[model samples]
Target: MRFFEATHKYPFDWETVSLASFRKYPNDKTPHVQHVEVLNQEIDPETGVLKTERLIMVKQNAPRLMMKLLGGSDSSYVLEYSEVDPRDKTLTMHSTNLTFSNLLTVGEKIVYKPDPEDTKNSTLFAQSAKLSADGVLSRFSSYIEETCLKRFHDNALVGKLGLEQVLHKILAEKRQERGGAGNMAA
Candidate 1:
């Protein structure tokens, strides 16, 4: 098994970043992400935390040879669980690939929170993922893990760019709404 961890600072507030994180899919930068379906959601009455489970469909980025060996389709499913703590201004998510569990397992965790070091409105993003190969792929586990890790690095940048695109779009909408409201009052 191999693992990687990284951190980034999104020049947006925690609320904005957290909101964009949930809505970060379906962007041109990360076209691999196809669909997301909320399986369950609920709010804690006492703690006021929101919990949700979602299934995400994404295109598999495996090598062609690996794909042929596995004889699997291009699409893969991932199961994710997340929590939002409004009081703490934190959002956390955990996800695991479900399609090729017999041969490989990929698990990830991500967290978003207010940047403690940055007084200038920003959010800290931290993420980690573990990759492992088993069964038929065990012989090439190290190489597979290394390849996946390299891909993860590229995808991480793409994911952040996707979120930024979403956030920009949302901010523009907000600006337009405010402009419309001002015009209405005039």
Candidate 2:
């Protein structure tokens, strides 16, 4: 098994960051993410946290050899569960690949919260993943994990850019709304 983790600071508050995350997909930077379907969504009665589950379809590029070894398809499905705690001002999500489980498994966790250093204006983004291979391909597990780990890292950079793109849009819309409201009041 192999592990990967990283953190970033978004120049926005936790609320904005969390909202951007929901709209992060369908952006140009991560075209590999083709579809996202919400399986269920609800609010916890006691905690008041929003709970959600989603099914994601992704098509990522991989080495030809690896692709052929893993059924020659670049598309895979992932199941993700997430929680949004308004009281704590945090959003956490965990996901795992559902396809090719017998050959490999990719489990990922991500979190967005107020930055301890700059709580008001910045948000902290953190993510980690575990990669493992099994079945008759155990021998090549290291290679598979290493290759996928590299791909994962590559995707991570673009993922951040993609989220930022969405965040910028959200901020822009908010500014426009405020401007329009101010004009009306004038």
Best by lDDT: 2
TM-score of each: 0.94, 0.95
lDDT of 2: 0.91
Model 1 Cα lDDT, one tens digit per residue, 40-159: 999999999999999999985789988888798999999999999999988999999899887778899999989998734899989999988864446688888888888888888899
> Which residue runs does candidate 2 get wrong by more than 4 Å?
none
Positional deviation of 25 in candidate 1, in angstroms?
A: 1.2
| Candidate models: Cα lDDT each | 0.89, 0.91
Clash count per candidate: 0, 0
Q: What lDDT tens digits, residue by residue, belong to model 2 across residues 1-186?
A: 889999999999999999999999999999999999999999999999999999999997777887776565788899999999999999999999988777779999999999989999999999999988865366788888888899989989999999999999999999999999999999
- Candidate 2: residue 99 lDDT (0-100): 82
